[model samples]
Target chain A: MTTLLPRAGARPPGRGPRTAARRRERLTALGMVSPAVLLLLVFFVIPVVLAFALAFTSARLISPTPAHFVGLRNFTLLFQDPVFFRSLLNTAVFAAVVVPVQAGLALALALLVNTKVGGTNFFRTVYFVPVVTSMVVISIVWMFLYQKTGLVNHLIDTFSLGHLHGPDWLNDPSTALPAIIFMSVWQGVGFHMVIWLSGLQTIPADLHEAAAIDGADRWARFRHVTWPGLRATRTFVLITITIDALRLFTQVNVMTQGGPLDSTTTVVYQAVHTGYDQQQTAYASAISLVFFVLVLAVSLVQRFLTREKD
Target chain B: MATTPTPAPGPRRRTLRRIPGHLLRSALALLFVFPVVFMLISSFKPDQQIFADLGSIKAFLPVGQLSLDNYTAVFDRVPAGRFLLNSIVISAVTVVLGIVVNSLAAFALSRMRWPGRRLLLVLIIATLIVPFETFALPLVWWVNKLPWLELNGFHLALTEGWLDTYRVQILPFVANAFSVFLFHQYFQSIPKELDEAARMDGASWFGIYRRIVMPLSGPAVATVAILTFLPMWNSYLWPLMVVQDENLRPVMVGIQYFFQLNVSWGQIMAYSTMITVPVLALFLAFQRSFINSIASSGVKG
Candidate 1:
């Protein structure tokens, strides 16, 4: 709602030559923006409208015949279908777990590197290496490590924790989603850490100095000063992570293919599966519309929660 | 205890306190770095040795029975060279076009005074919330019907569709909302006096952008370029949906080609290494700018 609100007019009153100059400026602006506007209209705006329209129809991708509208049927079917509900639940659980865990770990890492330590840049770079690597590549690498006789289990055995045998990570339904979550957190924490680091740097040094002068310990300083400063950044990280978690597809696609019993099936993955693999275009469109609504709702809630107090 | 004067801690005590923090940080950093390292090292080792070395830290070490055999096998199994070339071309073109188009739009919104600019910006920013997954199917259908100019055996011919081509992979992504927003933000920070001065000297709007604004926006350009290149390089879902031709498939789609029944671990590692090395190199080279951009934009890589 805030982003959608129009700003009050700021143009100054003028006449004659100024009006002509203003027209020229407007024309120039139009010329500059037309390419991007046109592209967005074609690719984003129109497609979104079409997606909404398609969700109401019984459309099949491969069918030659024209499709007919089936009002509320797709949504009704989605609600009734156990697999659809399972996917929704899986995505919800994934977001619930990963968002906080990833954000917390990232904050911790940011605090660690924020200390005036030697070679902090080197560690920052090292942590961010996984972030730059493609998700497909990371998933493939992790798939190898998640094998039964894989490096992960081998390491566990070598470290004298042999009693706690590592389960076949991606293959076992019980551990599959959690395994992917762990890998995702590992890959994503660096990104949030960098965000937190920037937020940490923005906190005025004088505030910390004053807190120390007031006999505050490091823990007290962090709780009172640092946490307050990072409220917005924390909210941003939380929402972004939740959204990213909901869209979990590449890992599931590359590693598990939503299998070992669909433990890792997410909304986006299900949409892709239903639409592309099953050719249930209308149903997939419905699923996507629901997802879009969920995302928008969450973002709105986050914005409301983080809005500045009057 | 209050009456006693405590001696200041020596340098040794300070060093001792720092050692634990440094060690812990290093260990955690190593945890993140190990997978990529393992991928690189495993690519050099043969399949048996990769498994043999798995029990110890040697799994991450580039030692024992090392050869480029897996690399050779990867090339044989998948068209590694073609995939790499395709990805580079797609990513490069997307980055270039994205910079030009998005920056122009941003300049309009941020610099030129015009009616509806605010509304236009809001609309552009609003699109950021709509994830591509939500509308990808519709986009596919639309692009399937879109026109293209194809060079059919050196005779330029009009085509009805944009599918199964590099343009299909690149065009949709070139007009990025986030990039436009980022460039807009960066442009706002530049002083308006510079633009006004250029205009006073009889410079056109395009000339002002080219000579005055773009020249001073190196960091912004770098950030947008890096951000644009990343998604294009790692594009998976779009290409998968639109492209069925193996020749036009990006490196990400080529990854699925290796996911056959007999899972060749070494070859997988080799293929991953090949795809990942360029990204790692790019990050290493633009480490500062990449971090700065992400930090400023609050965008995840």
Candidate 2:
């Protein structure tokens, strides 16, 4: 194991069998990587570059007219539009609420299921069913459940014995975004729970036992040991949840269509709404560019915030 | 944390402590499963009966006149079978191609020393931070103008645009950044000495990748497959943009068809259940892999 690896530095001055082998290896590596590179360049790289370039052009999705440079026209229009502003605010609000709520809930869940008792796996599996289930499916089912005569209202009626009525959840503007936020959290929290549980497991049990021996109670041990151990998982959960919250489109597209006076409209939802539905490729690109900037800014801030103090 | 060499809690006290945990777990588990259970249960009942039973606990239980009537009605209402088949083919192809391509790239990056390897890896990983929604509109516009070479009988013809095709759905997703990262991370755990030994045995790099590295990478393969398949199967926004052909629509987009006018709750539940059950069954079957892979993806953070 102590033997030093023979790198290119180790190769004697050129034209040796080892040199030939190294060249062949490099060629094979290139061949192997090219397929992935080509695909990514075509799909991810080009499109991302296009996202930037097309933002300043008057490009239509499927038009006969060639795209012309439009300068700040799209941005000016975007600033003037109230719906886009609402969408951005809604995205921020969604992320602001979901990041903490989902991450905290997931940590709680991870701790609960991390016990070495029986049925932990069963509990984990049951909790993860919604994570595996499609958001589209969830949105549809919850749409039904949120109806005026749905199970949610019925349960409210039953619990109150006909004293109170649940609001029309997806229809009422006030409750629409909150309702979607709740479902989004429910659908995604299981994923972060697994992440947090893994982090918890990596925290050596002896630390907790040592803390316990030192008279640290449950909360004290958690604060000192468990919380510190979950730094990576916490960063992962918060960032993923925030990104996901900001990309809140499926439920909006499926359940509410960003409806009830655009209360539930998210940046991504409006991006799709304008990009695909209206075919204004350039304008949609502008929205998407802003969306990308928001994601980048938020992620950078999160990374900075979650960086290890030491 | 439970492993203690010293005097542990007495058996009665331990049981009492576990009691709260069990109760809490049971309660949380119930809360998580309730909506799915309601969807499944409601899929079988008539619309009226679904609402009728909603006032009671029976909303979640399979009570009263249960039938496959709504499931059958789902087929009558839309081309559910076509959507299912489309999603299956699209997701399956995407997963397979993704594993092959991404893992190969990972093999080259992780197992060999080459010029530009480090730069390529960083570039690929950098794409991971950008969400799909950010570039989806531009991708849509780009694909709309991109050309495809299609075979017509014996002739190869260049067809413009990939909209309304399976390739549009599958191709863009085949070179996933995270899958490549996963494979690279997994490959690093394999000792580099093995590659040298294989080279000493006169094995070519591709040979080593196929006969040695790939065969040893079952867990990575499964992890990549499951992760890739989930998004592909649940792919709504992409296909909703690209595919307008009813015959080419995936299941997630099928939900939109039910939303047009007079909405049928039972049929919606039925379709939702139909699309969701297969993924759930797959998840339960590969529960450990699903859980562990998602957990391990925290390596990025």
Candidate 3:
């Protein structure tokens, strides 16, 4: 797309006496670009700076009284809050469970459907149904499905010959977060499967044929070639799953609302809870700052762990 | 993993080996789709029938008395039509604006030389790392204090706060970093010589972007559109915070309204099905582009 040679009808290579056309190019480019740049500045950059600044203030969501700087107050209170701790723990537990399980399962599903067989499209489409469906709908549907006498429990009981009884999935403290996690993975895995399938396509057929000719077995070919070939996709799947798991607000918001004694509380959910519902803007800002750092730290750690190790 | 796209004609029994794999995949696919299948089927049934059918595989089948009663009742119980309209307006506006704005910005960044182009590209990409949730809370407060101009008593008035409006939902999501990046990557595939050739003909830069570059970038546009539309249409958390007016609420937030009042399960399924089916239809229609767009997000970004 680029060339080192001088462009045809190129302007003279001098700083002085720039052409009117050249001047217009700069203006045109800026004019074209400024709308997006301005919007990002207002919506993204300013809010990020505000997140940091508002953390140390006592601002309310909508208040008549002006906010003043409150040094370490929000952080101190956040450290003491059991709900905050639970949210943090729940977030970590989710990312840890989801990153491996989702990524591995997606890769397997991708492999299963990557065959050049008939009905491959059908299988791919079915696997991706959840990805296409919105999370809110999925959550609501699963809310019914996860009931003690819902379809899931009914299936379990039938499979176990009527000996097993299921508890309320969203109501019980122990099962609430896990239930959400299960549904989240079920909704999201198809997406990663698509990514893996694409990655699989990119691995040239000759490489696999050559490996097979060299007497590699099924698992050996996968372990050596397919797995290694998916390094970039693997990194992507892991990082995305982790980030999404950390930013687990919508499902919890829809299904649990951080309920069952705050057992399903997530960092993002807690931020919204205090920020909007509780109208404690400053406190939420502090939580947001910490969350931003946690995401940053986890991403860097992932990068370090997954970096080229040759 | 067979390397061949098509299997060879061999011993007749060789094809039988694939049956087990096919069966496994079909079972896995069934597990993936059954819940949505159940939802779609359950939407047509009454509550008592729904509960009765739940104990058997009939829960996922429309075997019982099926009718449009739940759909009709959904309208009476809540403003399902209004919420769907609001979501369509918001998501459609945001996606259209996002494609146009991000592509233009990407064109400028990729095609033209400018003083701060490199720095600007870097800056835009940097914003992608900060997930929206991190700034969502502050963004609520920030948008509230922001000003809007509206016609008041036959004259334009400076109004404070963008809370409870369509623009609040649309504008913030329009200038997406990922969309701009996708456009940039896609534009790079188009030959720069086309731009130079068009410019040599006394065409304006915007003319090149419009007449030449953009028309050739249909794939990029589709990818950006799908990616943009999904999140905007599925947007829940932001609207929950910023939008308080019922009329301004999108479907995701509207679903919450229906979720409350202890509604019947049949009605909830009906509402869920109503909101979801259109998107699912779009997915089926544009499955290739949708899959590619998602894959590009993973592979490139």
Best prediction by DockQ: 3
Write down the C-alpha DockQ for each prediction. Answer: 0.63, 0.78, 0.79
Q: 1 or 2, which is superior by TM-score?
A: 2
Q: Write out the backbone clash pairs for model 3.
A: none
Kindly list the per-residue Cα lDDT of model 1 for residues B50-151, writing each as its tens digit: 888888878888889889998998787777899899999999989999999999999999999888999999989988888899898867767877887768
TM-score of chain A of each: 0.92, 0.94, 0.93
Q: Local distance difference test, per candidate?
A: 0.87, 0.89, 0.90
* Top of the candidates by TM-score: 3
iRMS values in order, in angstroms?
1.8, 1.0, 0.8
Distance (Å) between predicted and true CA of B216, model 2? 0.7
User: How well is each residue in A146-203 modelled by candidate 2, as lDDT tens digits?
Assistant: 8988878887898898999999999999999999988899989998888888888889
What's the distance in Å from true for residue A123, model 2?
Answer: 1.0
What candidate 3 gets wrong by more than 4 Å, as runs, is A1-18, B1-10
TM-score of each: 0.93, 0.95, 0.95
Tell me the native contact fraction for each prediction. Answer: 0.75, 0.89, 0.81
10 residues in a row with least lDDT, candidate 1 chain B: B1-10
Give the distance in Å from residue A133's predicted Cα in candidate 2 to where it truly belongs: 0.5
Model 2 lDDT, full chain set: 0.89
